[model samples]
Target chain A: MTTREIILARLRAALAPAPAPVEAPREYRRDAPVDLDRLVDRLTDYRAHVHRVAEPAVADTVAAILPAGATVVVPPALPPAWLPATVTARSDDDLDHTTIAAADGVITAAAVAIADTGTVILDGSPDQGRRVLSLLPDLHICVIRTAQVVANVPQALSRLTPHRPLTWISGPSATSDIELNRVEGVHGPRTLHLILLP
Target chain B: MSRTFLGMPTTAPKGVGHLRGAEPFPAAARRALSDAQLRRNLGHATATIRAKSGAVVAEVPDWEQLRAAGSAIKADAMARLPELLEQLEQRVTDAGGVVHWAADANEANAIVVDLVRATGSDRVIKVKSMVTQEIGLNEALEAAGIAPVETDLAELIVQLGEDRPSHILVPAIHRNRAEIREIFLRAMPGVDPGLTDEPAVLAAAARRFLRQTFLSTPVAVSGANFAVAETGTLAVVESEGNGRMCLTLPRTLITVMGVEKVVPTWRDLEVFLQLLPRASTGERMNPYTSMWTGVSPGDGPQEFHLVLLDNGRSAVLADEVGRQALHCIRCSACLNVCPVYERTGGHAYGSVYPGPIGAVLSPQLTGVADNASLPYASSLCGACYDACPVKINIPELLVHLRDQAPHPRGESAAMAAAAYAMDHPALYAAAQRATRLSRLTGRRGRGLPPPLSGWTADRDLPEPPAQTFRQWWASR
Candidate 1:
């Protein structure tokens, strides 16, 4: 018999008189109001710069966060208005790793945000292009709409489509390997700027 | 090798994986305990993580409820594992991914090596995965003339030092900053002439060294933290963006996952995603978590292969009471909280999996006879049970395995004798009275003679009082 058949048969035989099914108790909090302040607190705790701005000022905020004349990679569908003329913006149009790595930063809109854990979810949506676009760059400038914020993981997960590739970012890359001391900024983007729009 | 002509084997062959240590736990633990430096590193690391994990866990008022839910989901998944795995395979295939099954470590390793060869990549970057370590995949790749680059910082440290991983969350928890700096300076190519012991500086050195490889590596191998059966989605939770660099940059991504890692649905992630980060690295969420269902065109890796590795997981699942060991999320919370682990460190347990979880898990995977000493490695303090986010009752599993473990004839006889004496009040009192003879040796016996000495070698045998407690009570 094939290894697959052998393994499945072994499993079946082992579970002969299969145990009774158990219903998971999901009594944990869910579907609660998104607390923006809590989200800000968590992001700040992780050393990510957070800026609360009016929807109209998002363009100005993105511009101010980037160094003048810096090159930034943006998703193909990112709103043209969000990219100020001050920075040279390049769309991720079949960008290679080297090209993505060469960019000074990356800007993208998030799919959802979790307040309790201070994480931003990016599905490979039109605005959040490819996962590599955010990964290779040194700085990641993520724009989160207030409507996109959720209370916790379950709520944020409900909003995500599983088939789309997803990347959840809680903070800039970090490691606690050395003496268990948390040192932020490893292979991932070292600088994270979160622009919260209402 | 003898040509065996015998009756059919009564049981399946025991695991030939990295489940057994070179020596028994007591001997290995003796060597580790003598390393004062290792003890200090373990003590400091465990204390720091315990504080951090406690603080974050306390933040959530519903942590207990979450733990309950996490435990139940895993139990439910195990009860219907065959169905979930089949579902996972079907979904992954439907999503344009290939799925392979391996019944043992050798099969799994051969499959991965061939897959890498098929891609014609002599070198493959890797994410830190316990299953790969358990299977010794790196060695297998090297034997096939392939070099596997470890991207995770701790794993890199362990690799460069030619060291075994001593902890789960931070594999190099035994390494302090100065030691890491020394390793980097000695082993890493193009390392700065003057490297500081600062954690950030060391991390930067790694980033600089690996950035080129991450950009160029054509193939990557990873282990899934969770694989959703319903959607065929695989999630890898990591701190550094190295996981993204691997899962995204590589053209052909191969993920080796134990069959037990499969969850019933995508939504089940909510429970684990919450429980894992707090229990591991004491974070609200790891910096990056990448979830991909098979392959996403024009996005991450276009070709994905999920290797479902049984490698004794089915054997572990076979035992009714012992099956709960499969529920572990590899958070290493139990390791951090275990007093015995804090003292002797991971090396003592002698398995890639070390600490309270490993004590029970290793024995069952390799069978009780092979890893007999590990079941007794714990103090049965119940700390691991309390710390487990999935609520694995490790202390209970330890006792259960101990029952199955082979005991020396002398030890068994001693226990049986003690049990018989306790059954008879007169004999018990006489036995207690006879213990007074031990006082003649000294304030303490120091060490027992012959067969009994093994038990007292690592532990202290308190001196018998001048009078028995029962005698004193009767006099009063």
Candidate 2:
């Protein structure tokens, strides 16, 4: 059989619908044109910022949140002003695992966020940086542009390919291993903070 | 590698599907529920990941649509896999990377062994790779008297403890920090004897332990998350730098990639890069995502080899009901959310491929006629189906297997008994009423009866509904 025919047959067998499609169409638990304001309001558990502002003030916002004496992991190619002077930060290339593990909070720019799912996208770009810095630190503060938010996975796919490397972040690295009881901050960051800069 | 490579043992056979998926999930689950410790670890891990995944996924206005696109793209690719693979091989070869087509597990292992031997290297540091694990590359090398050092921290701990991976993303998810410290003490050649269970301390211990391997190892073996046919580029995404070290420092790099990992173009990578980490480790981006095309002149590894193994994949494709299994990315997100996997752990799946993906993938790879036990490994509750990003109907496939497979006589007997009860409404009523009596034909208590004990063995059956729906309907 032709390869296309074989693939369709396999899918047909896997589905085995009597007439109409057995697999349900994609679902959304949220109302259409979902509440972005409400979503961003509650997205992060940590103290956060949800202001409608320009891209340039990211440094000031991050600076306000970072406490004194907190070590920050800045991606090697980050915009210098994205971070405040109060935080002692190292470049992504120079920082080791030890420095990341000891740091109080991590801050980085995001690739995109899906409002429907309350998720963020990270590619290995200077803007998004590497995965470890966001993961190892106890707290994470992410900066996002409103325009980057897409409505669905399909639209997002149109923007991506197997070009380089990409990473997707939802909330934080957590486990529910302790007695079916959830304990965050075991392996990855315990607290997640997101900033929506319009 | 600049240094010579070692070979696999002569006559080392690829165990292949000689063995079925011998999972101990049911038994392991029963024991894990009570161990408080294991449950605690899993519960905490899954809950945090779930919430995080849910949140980040929410940020995407079209997350579900994206999942659909991702699933559809993979489905579309699988139909044209052969052509894509040939295209991938041509591109890699044209770009100067040696492409080895391995027909089966043994052939893949032997080819890798010979490749390493050709390099004249006896020892190689390895990045955490599921393909090599599936092929038993380490064991094959060890039998040939080579030590393949695991550089990924979790993998190193697992190797040291001689333990199986419990979770896909966190291979050592079963062990607590205290247990990890113990493993380090017993396994490390000369690790800090008084290390604490603190994450910092453990990170330090692993860092010191791996530093030498990173600087000294001449060869590294890896698995690619995505192979871009357009650019002949192979990519490895990770939260730790060890994967980068393996991709670089080594003189020769060998990648074991499943034939299904190829994507048509580089631009298509955006969808997966966005989906993978959030699905696997709940990260926005992996710590290190290194991409290289074939062999480079003065940069990174001077020599490169890509071994594409079919193993049982072609066999899987031949079966109409099972071929969708190839769309899997091995992200382990399904494993994390699956109640079955939560309790049974990865080792219970009985193979390098674990979780729901493994359940479907293994049975198909090995064939339903052989690994029949795997399909029955689930409750068919459809949790796995819900968790799968590719929309693979794992539960439905499981039932299909059940129908196609010759059920063990025990299962057939059990199913027959169940069918009998359902067929005869009066008999079902009587049995349901009778089961409320806890006595095994001995006591006068209301609980569970003897004949139906197996169904309620690990679970508490609903105290036979106080009133049958039929009786209520009759009265009405």
Candidate 3:
């Protein structure tokens, strides 16, 4: 046998046999009753923003965190929030470096979302604008739907195809190694707010 | 041979002082068995890094493509490394910079200490370079009466704390704000009397402390993120401006980088530019990416010394399957995602390099003969491989190293027996049948013999089923 074949044979013997083929690798499960407070704390540790968005609850959350007439970013395909129509959002259209950097924040919907790892997938297209907008912004308010969330990375990957561009977000951007020291806001958002819907 | 990676003192005893009777990884892990503080620190730090990396990485549309590009670029760099090194040597020589080649860590250290001593400087400011750490540069410098002051904020914390780094990206990740405050209060030469653990407060204190070193220090040391063969440029990326200070301000700058750190051209940087920043700090772009080509006139440092240290990298490079490790961007994304690193922290690994990348990379560099137990330091979880942007199959490499490495004593022979048993069908079947007795005791199975007892010490081996799967298959 060739070297590749020999190696593959050894690897095949090493690994447990592949499980009987399943129709789909995706295994959807209902959200278990996670302690919201614990979830918030855990997500916050990762620089995630947590706010309840049950109709009346969301507007209050947004208003509480952001001041009036504050520039908030939203995708063209975003769910409507009660912000005044006049409060202009920088859409993901004609998004050059200059325009994106100038904006206060840019929000986008997730692709294959993971709840176990608490990640949201954003594939940079029109809505996700080059991945720089969400990263550079001082504050990012991510919109996550219940159905969008999967249990684990495997499930998330199964839902995602290789064709589309995909970005998986779990928490805020931070670094700790300058002193074995943890420093957030090195290159990404110092603040991360996640909008969760039931 | 040049010992470029292992920076030990000539004055020190030739033999390794401790770890003679040190049990394998599992036995050493017993010391940390009750250390809750270490666990808490590691767990919190790794989880946080993972979350942040997940967040920004999710926003990118072409992240996979970018990863592929990064992997391809690194692969390209590795495949033609010898040619590139020769090219880089010619280029660096053509430029004003002096290039030194060392085959191992000892040669690298001797060359550097001699050069620094020749310059008659007792102190040198340092940029946070893993190569220097791997070579034990600080300790080596201290032995030679040269103080290598770390200028990076995080690096400053680790240096002052007199502590080893835990996470690659966040070396002092074990330190909380309150702990940092305590470290500063004790170590800083003229630390603020009443310092809080506030990140900004700590940062200000470090900045104040290092500002003098940055301005006055005549000699500087650093490791490169990428070395360009085309222009002989050394690239370093950092969040704080300290790395910039180390790279510039000083009259004499010495960069000790691994042979693997070289990239072929300037444009190849585009792939790593995206791959490294996001994978490391979880950023779109590193805050400060400073690149210097040889020595510039009337610009930064005039005298540039590039020490190309082989250490044991040639052995690693020789292995076709294992050479992919050289492709590491040093992003530390793997460590963030690794459960083992999250529990043990970097210190338990007993090396400058830690975590999954460190587990493979350090042993490869330092020679597994010296630190034989390190390869098994991890649980072979593929979390690191999944997280690696360049797709380094780190777990596979770890197992491969453990198999190939000679034991410091006769420990490797024991593993050989285990490997034999696993590879042999009858032995595996017999072992499975022997394990069948534990079925009677269920999950609380005990009395499994010496090495088997080691397995039961930490975890209950899965009780054999009423019928072995083989039995069922045979009957069917």
lDDT of 1: 0.90
Q: Give the DockQ of candidate 1.
A: 0.67
List ranges where model 1 is wrong by over 4 Å: B1-17, B440-448, B468-476
TM-score of model number 1: 0.96
The ten-residue window of minimal lDDT in model 1 chain A covers A8-17
Candidate 3 lDDT for residue A159 = 62
* lDDT for residue B248 in candidate 2, whole number 0-100: 62
lDDT of 2 at B332: 80
Each candidate's TM vs. the true structure?
A: 0.96, 0.68, 0.66
- How close is each model in CA RMSD to the real structure? 2.6, 9.1, 13.9
* Interface RMS for model 2: 10.2
Strongest candidate by TM-score? 1
Give one digit per residue, the lDDT tens place, for model 3 in B202-307: 7767766766676678888999888888767677877655665576567888999887799877656655665786788765444455666676564467798998
Predicted candidate 1 versus true structure: per-residue lDDT over B307-351, tens digit per residue: 998777777888899999999999999999999999999988888
DockQ (Cα-based) per candidate?
0.67, 0.08, 0.04
lDDT of 2 at B191: 86
Q: Rank by DockQ, descending?
A: 1, 2, 3
- Candidate 2 chain B, run of 10 with poorest lDDT: B3-12
